[model samples]
Target: MDFPCIDRLEMRQRDLMAGPEPTYEKVVTGYELFHDSTPFVCDHGGVLPQMDVAYESWGRLNADRSNAILIHTGLSGSSHARSHAKNSRPGWWEKFIGPGLAIDTDRFFVVCTNVIGGCYGSTGPWSVNPATGQRYATTFPLLTVNDMVRAQFRLLDHLGIHKLHASVGASMGGMQSLCAAALHPERVGRLVTISACARSHPYSIALRFAQRQALMADPNFRRGFYYDGVQPHVGMKLARAVATVTYRSGPEWELRFGRRRRAPDQPPALCPDFLIETYLDHQSERFCLQYDANSLLYVSKAMDMFDISQSVTRRLAAQREHAAADLGHELATTAAACANVSVCMNIEDQPASTTGHSQAETEDEIAQDLIAGVRNAKQPTLVLGVQSDILFPVKQQREIAEILRRAGNERVTYYELDAMYGHDTFLIDVVNVGAAIKGHLENTT
Candidate 1:
């Protein structure tokens, strides 16, 4: 979509184009992600048979199609990843994905899709279920990272893309990248999973559960059936606040909100508060303003179901527990049938498949390996992250680099960016990060 005089307009105009009108406003020279309708599959096991795939692009696709770089964004991110002919605020990751930047359009074909449950143009919980003609709302499918990846695969298929030069993402996006690798290994030439784990960590699940609870607990949350009228802002904001803490680091919080007290001039001994409180307050408010409660539940639940532990776990407790009077009987059972389960690791992620009890390092190591895959791939991978990143810590990025080194994926490299702006850096530091990504893309090919 060509860049409309978008910067001149506020949040109001963006809503109109991506919201109601069915037209493609130009975003750049030749790149555009037209506003199109996609169907949400409800008739088939609550499947989104058709869904909107909003996107923007640059440069041109070579006839060979080998240059396409498929980008999957994190939770709450849209397809606006760069600036167009006339816009200023640029796009989300516009910093790293344009003309002369890392994901240089001149050299690569880039395509970013709004995930299935995303509020963007994608057909999500808020999307109208073609059957009922009402927003799917709570009726939306219980989607997974694999589902999101499947949706993208279909989009690429629709675009006639049989193979990809690389697939990339951070946080939830990173999770999608890994899922793509696992589910459809041959499709990607290179893969990157930055600051993300193979499966949802228990702590992460707890936090998301809390957020969901906050939203559902609200009188507005009417079960998964809130579409009748009442919306759940208070519940969603409370959940956002819970998530916000995890996105940032404790030390960062100390620096951001630790010094100042609200009652003016209170000393440190007063357990003083700082400006960060106000910052989180405003962020939580704004987040709730744009996102829907049901969307939060769907995405967060998807993350919860991810079993990054899948690829590494070679044995299933159900299979192990079955009284195999005859070994031949095992083939008929399923993994989820087990009562108490423990994953058996392989030599790749662990020294041995020892499973007397769950080892913290075992879990952390598996997650670390996934993150490392992004930084050190035998193929090309671009990693962009914040220095004081409270969300996906710089330490995590460093760990990613180390893991890449260990994995022998030396081709992988990282861009440790400066976004003092904290966890929202990916969303806020678009200009600089976009440039960094663009440069990386240019250097790779």
Candidate 2:
């Protein structure tokens, strides 16, 4: 009895064993775009006929295509994670990247890509829609952390990276990193998420809502259609000022700016009298025009709407639906692969097999859902939380570690930092944060 499926499986094993290992050349060290004409379906109902992802990379991919690390950016950061030959300017994470740094570009092929809805080179509110030949502006589709990761996946496929050695991020970047590994456990080997939560809390959502309100209040905003006119500078400034307040601790601010007047000699005015006020003014002034207002609204909302439990439900349901249509084929394939026991063993690190169980089998418990979301992420995980960060409290980080542990991820490492820098501790307190990251990256076990 000659079984065709078993014969094909044996031939696949022979091809794998006989061939020389494939190798990929290192990516160019500069800004690049991965363009896909295929319609990108959004988590929401919106769709894009064509899209582009702007990215930058450093170091070399090994011959076996391992040792690749993908770094996600904070809410406003771009793809420039580190300085390269093409771009000499220092990046947002300049201190943490490069040779002998926390990320160690010398050992890992590090890459960072601006989120699709960002104001950077990637397609967003600023990009012109091919269908209408006009800018998408506020008309762009609603974005989610999952949508952002899915878009990044397109770029990864283009670069021929089948899997990532690690995915790292802080703040909103942390949210993206967590979502990436949860949604595609097979694609990411290790995970590091700092100052992030499994879901957006009420306080954080309120803060982001206030930022949106400020931006929308400007007459020039014109309901997010201010692209061709004088920008809503006042609104944007106020919004940034509000966001800046949440980025650091009040205790740190007291030490940095205190009650000192901007100018003691000058009589008090209605505006920017205190040093702290002036500091906020400087921060907002520099930011108001740099980023697109609509992008700020979109990305922040995405962060607000993110809930890992909901995401897991959606993913599992989709997988169940897909499996229902091809149960016979799946059984045959599983049988054929079982015939080649060694071949199956060689790929043991692959994603866990999805049972043909109905989606209803998964309970609606939120805690259970959170656990389920990351259940298959058997990688070494690092979760960092800053005690002084009011926006994303340390408890959120604790929850992440607890959930991962409950999910049976034994390699999870949790850190509670007491840095005075608050939510921005990851950016300023590099000595502590760097050491934590360096240790995690080097841990091969």
Candidate 3:
């Protein structure tokens, strides 16, 4: 299908800044790290000579430096989680994070950093490769949730933050929070994960594969080396269109635009005909304007490849029994199904193994580690799930809470929000989302 040309696309930033609501007065200072002497190592054994990570912070670091919160972004989010003194464009989580809001910047120091493999200021496919003098493009090594967490840890160390009072994230960000809590149990005191899972389900992986295929289908993509020429805007638009559908619930679409034609009196044309089609088109266009095509490819793949169980298993081998009886059995069955697909489809480049272990063994170990982490986690954790969410179903959230409870962690709590917004409920349903987070923080304190 023909899509809008990248050159003709008008870039219009969303008007999220204008509001009467109170915002943080502290200057949102921007910071960059990992660009000089430190080289970042990827989970796939690849190394970047130097990497750049862009981040923003608000509020004041107390004398004891204990009132700090780290906010991780989703697949398309940046470091700008909320409005600040400088740029006022409201961030992705502006409603849930402000001076007197859910995060309460007035009393806590909040930091949000763009994930490494993102289109935002952080280093990714668009960044120039120090070795080749050109964009890394497809040459950028594959990344995982753990790799992103490790990068965030460097930022925390740079800021002299030894421990976080709380770590919060939704969607892809939730995966990062899970990784942080599991990998560095002592660094994070409280954890909140919304609409996230321990690992990508096969259905989610299939959806991601379709998006990647859409991008690669464009001849102008040139295998992600389209820096000097026309971009694959059509592919990117199509990919976003697919993702937008998964982000919302079917009930939402039916209630918002039920078979309503864009033009009531006119006949259907080659372009969008229904109101839903128009909505998807608008979302796709907006995404294409703001995000990098290659970055989307990388970030989505990272989400699909994320398996917190693997990271936990690789770290604490002694806690295998906790996982073996519960999560391990389920994970092994899923891995077997995935293996069957891989063999039948002849797709050999599986990104499951973080270490040198075989895929089957690694999957088994991950399940054990996940259970162990939940059992061993001393910090209070809150897992929030949206009832209508299909991408990361409520079942996933329940599984997280159940595993934690099974591991004998009494501090774990799970809440399911009743919202038609589906996976996007955490962003759109601020009242309930904010209340849950604030209540958890208060209880922990």
Query: Each prediction's Cα lDDT score?
Result: 0.60, 0.79, 0.74
Q: After superposition, how far is residue 347 of candidate 1 from its true place, in Å?
A: 37
lDDT of 1 by residue, 217-280 (tens): 8775677565555456567667887788777666666766775656566443312145666566
Q: For residues 1-445, could you state the per-residue lDDT of candidate 3 as single tens digits?
A: 4433332342221121222311111222344344533655455534445667788888889999999999999998888888776667788788888778899888899999988878667788888766557777777767777888888898888889999999889999998888788778899989999999877777888888898899889776788777766667678888999999989999999999999998889766657878999899889976654677778888988888776564434532322233233233333342332233221121124334443234666644655666775555667999999999988999888877876676777888899888999999988998999999998876744
Report the Cα lDDT for candidate 3: 0.74
Show how many residue pairs clash in every candidate, following the order shown: 41, 0, 0
Task: For candidate 2, list the clashing residue pairs, or say none.
Answer: none
User: What's the lDDT of the predicted structure labeled candidate 2?
Assistant: 0.79
Give the Cα error of residue 426 in candidate 3, in Å: 0.7
lDDT of 2 by residue, 113-150 (tens): 98988867788877887755777777776677888888
lDDT of 1 at 255: 64
Residues forming the 10-long window of minimal summed lDDT in candidate 3:
16-25
Q: What lDDT score is found at residue 221 in candidate 3?
A: 79
Poorly placed runs, candidate 1 (over 4 Å): 1-45, 85-89, 262-274, 309-378, 381-445
